[model samples]
Target: MTSSNGLSSLGPEGASAAARALSLPAESYGNDERLEAMWAMKAYNHAEVYFNLISSVDPKFLKLTKMDDEIYTKFRETFRDLDIKVLDPELLKSAEAKERWRPFCNCYEGLVEDFNFGTLLRLDCREDYTQDNSIFATRIQFFAVEIARNREGLNDAVFSAKSSKS
Candidate 1:
């Protein structure tokens, strides 16, 4: 599945279909290691906070769950695998990252605007951000929805193509 650009065929057909269904093949779908790093830090922070809250005097106030932490961790790893380099550590430590990655901010919006699921999911996760923690849950939500849609769409596309061919 080598692309015309000579990149390995973006992995496998199933993954390709998932990418297409997510509308991520055109952009925001490739190697993005830096973004991955930032996301990892943010997710770790989010999980840590959630765990502490769920176990402590403020558990009622935080109301976080192990499931929430798991999901965040999964998304963090997935984004890490992207190998994106949008936000360098030094750059992130700068004032610009602070302003740009603020909670409820759409800095990563550019990364997932191609698809409805991704966009919607981004919005959903923004609700969890704080001034101190800036990992965008929306990105994870968007990825999950996009991936699900991709799988479903791939099955449909293949089934239809096969039927038409027969």
Candidate 2:
């Protein structure tokens, strides 16, 4: 899809088109090659915060983590009941699908309101990236999924191995 500035929603190329449309200085746009790297860093920072929160084992977070687990387990059924596409990366590429998923993804309502949905990133969690495993999810989805993983002991092996090394 194209933005109002006539740029394809394909990251750097889109940003370049926006910069040109707005008559922005070349310096202002920085290195286009670095945009994805910067986004990855942002995602990493968010994950770090979530991991720290889970490490603390805060009661509210623990409760939410349990809820996230249940939600993910019943994801397909939830989508069916809501009449939306079941968790597919392709489905999340459109604004309409994002809106459809918004109600179910309201765990972080404040961040959701403030975030740019169009810039949502895809994260592939599998050993190999595939249509079924790669997820085009909002920032909140990453947090929810990771939190659930931590709470359900899925991340224990990694942490335990790390601690063993130390």
TM-score versus the correct structure, for each prediction: 0.23, 0.39
Cα lDDT over the full model 2: 0.45
lDDT of 2 by residue, 1-166 (tens): 1123222334787666544543443466577765444454344444444444443443233544334655556454445443121235545557886776676677446534422322222243211223344444565555444444545465554445444666
State each model's CA lDDT, in order. Answer: 0.35, 0.45
Best by TM-score: 2
In model 1, the Cα lDDT at residue 160 comes to 43
The clash number for model 1 is 9
Per candidate, the number of residue pairs that clash is 9, 0
Q: Candidate 1: misplaced stretches above 4 Å?
A: 1-29, 58-166
- Model 1 TM-score relative to the real fold: 0.23
Clashing pairs in 2: none
Residue 144 in model 2: lDDT: 46
